[model samples]
Target: MLFVPLPFVNALLLALVFVFLKKSNGATATRAFLMLIALCCLQSIVLGLRWGYNVDALRFVQPLLAALLPPLAYESFRGLVDQAAPGRFRLAAAPLAALVILGLMLAAPILLDSALVLLFLAYAVALARIAWRGPDGLGLARLDEAAAAHRALWLAAFCLCLSALFDLVILFDFERSGGSHAAILVSNANIVSLLLIGLAARTAGHAQTETNTEPEPAPQTATSEDAEIVARVDALMTAQHLHRDDTLNLSRLARRAGLPARQLSQAINRVCDMNVSRYVNDFRIKDVCTLLRQDGITVTEAMYRAGFSTKSNFNREFLRVTGMTPDQWRKAESRDLEQKDRMAR
Candidate 1:
């Protein structure tokens, strides 16, 4: 029997995501994200056909999807967060190359499952690393929104790991004529993962709207010149205390620093090893710490003064940067000061 509602709904939801994403504000990376989601949804259908319906003719779809997943995942991630992307056709060729690799898989069917599992685990680790660092690099966002975006990625990586587990289970089920539970679990997991991936694309994917107002500068090359750019940006940040603006964003910072957006982004990435959004938030975080050390200033007031829009945002960024909650950090500082006073006495 065909798995009608669930698999069909999964594909339909993925299609809707594709439609929305194509129209959404983003670049090559966004498109790659769409492709990644599409592949996942399609896998649900392919799996349904091969396993649920026992359609042996559609068996080829699995190897094709398997081959395309790893590169597409890595490329989508790079595009999502990087200042530059590979040439259009070059990026487009990844799946085609995967299709070409299918010949080797066909030649050695026994190695196919092992190789695919290894590739999935490798990309999952890479994705998790990028997520932990932050999603500020992926697109324009406020500090709070950037944290949410990165969390979306963390979830995506978790889902990918889950997908790999489901794959293994389905393989085992295929080997033993047993319960259909594994197939059901695999499809449902794909549905859940697709939903989260779509959320991440929405949360983090953005095209530069404000860039149209300014003359776009030529793309900066990777070179030592980035050092000077970073120094100048740092000076501007410190002198102006630009992070204190609650409305601060990459485009606005670029304007105030009198630098092209791309160059400024590159400088921040080079020197701070972070996206401009996170770099700015780091300043805000420091300011908050200083405020928290002072008496009579409430945490909410300090967070607001530091330019955070909400306490949740402040707490999330605080934990990520400081490894403690705002209240916990404040309490520790208070204890240290009390101990210092006793020593002075």
Candidate 2:
């Protein structure tokens, strides 16, 4: 009888997710997420080898992989909202820093663990700050999938923070028990953390497909700048039906409106009193309502016609905008029309 380790099972799960994402999106997904998932799978395999098979060589490799995860998580999400990434030197710095810490592990092992805890916590806080801005913060994410991306941002932050906590627990376990509990603690905690981080990164990558492009300058106006921006965006939305593009995002919408993404988001927030996702959904829901009112149009057809890609989002936005389900709205409309017709007769 062969025994398979849980970490190998976990690695298999992440591999499946990676394959699915690759097949679904091809090269469109941010490479950072793909790297993150690949690293996760590698880390899982390393863990399995070290703990399950007691591969002594992997004892040194584990911390290096641990150091890479947080930075990848940060880069994956940073790419979603921020069009400008750090310079090449800055990009090289993270790996260099990780290597420095790995070197320190040879002389002072505790320092490596402490640095990992701090690194994870720092990235967690950074992710949390971005997520605090709501879905609009994900300017590159599609309007329809922004909510999922926002949730994923929060989840990624929590996962990083949770990884920090588990490291602390492992440190205490090592101090109190000569690292007897380290295997079980790391196995269970890291498996959960890695899976969650993979899921979050995947969700974010799905919503983030836009390449960096220079945005057109917003019109310079003496007054009512927000209103002017909104008016221009509205005209674009109405004339081109930009809202009907299922892949539409704040960056794309801003580009079409000839406004910077941040400026466009802020203008919509002030003028419409809603985030970009909600404002875009407002247009989609309104279009869906019109479609629903027409004869021979099914609810699903209405949803798709109105640029809603998911039934849940379509239903949610429909209820939010119309205060009723599509069928209920249709029935109410029918009843009202019948009453009006009888009164006319």
For model 2 the local lDDT of residue 283 reads 90
Task: Give the Å error, residue 200, model 1.
Answer: 2.9
In the range 1-345, model 2's lDDT, one tens digit per residue, is 897878999999999888877876675566778888889999999988898888989989988898888878888888877678688855975697678778878888868889889989988998898788788877777889889999999999999999999999999998999899988988777899999888887787777768433222233442388988888888878888888898888878877887777788777777777788999999998888788778899989888878888888887888988899988988998899899999999
Among these predictions, the greatest TM-score belongs to 2
Clashing pairs for predicted structure model 2, backbone only: none
State the displacement of the C-alpha of residue 84, model 1, in Å, after optimal TM-score superposition.
2.4
lDDT of 1 by residue, 240-344 (tens): 888887756666777787876667776667666766667788888998999888889998999889888766777878898999999899889989999999999
Full-model lDDT for every candidate: 0.67, 0.83
Clashes of 2: 0
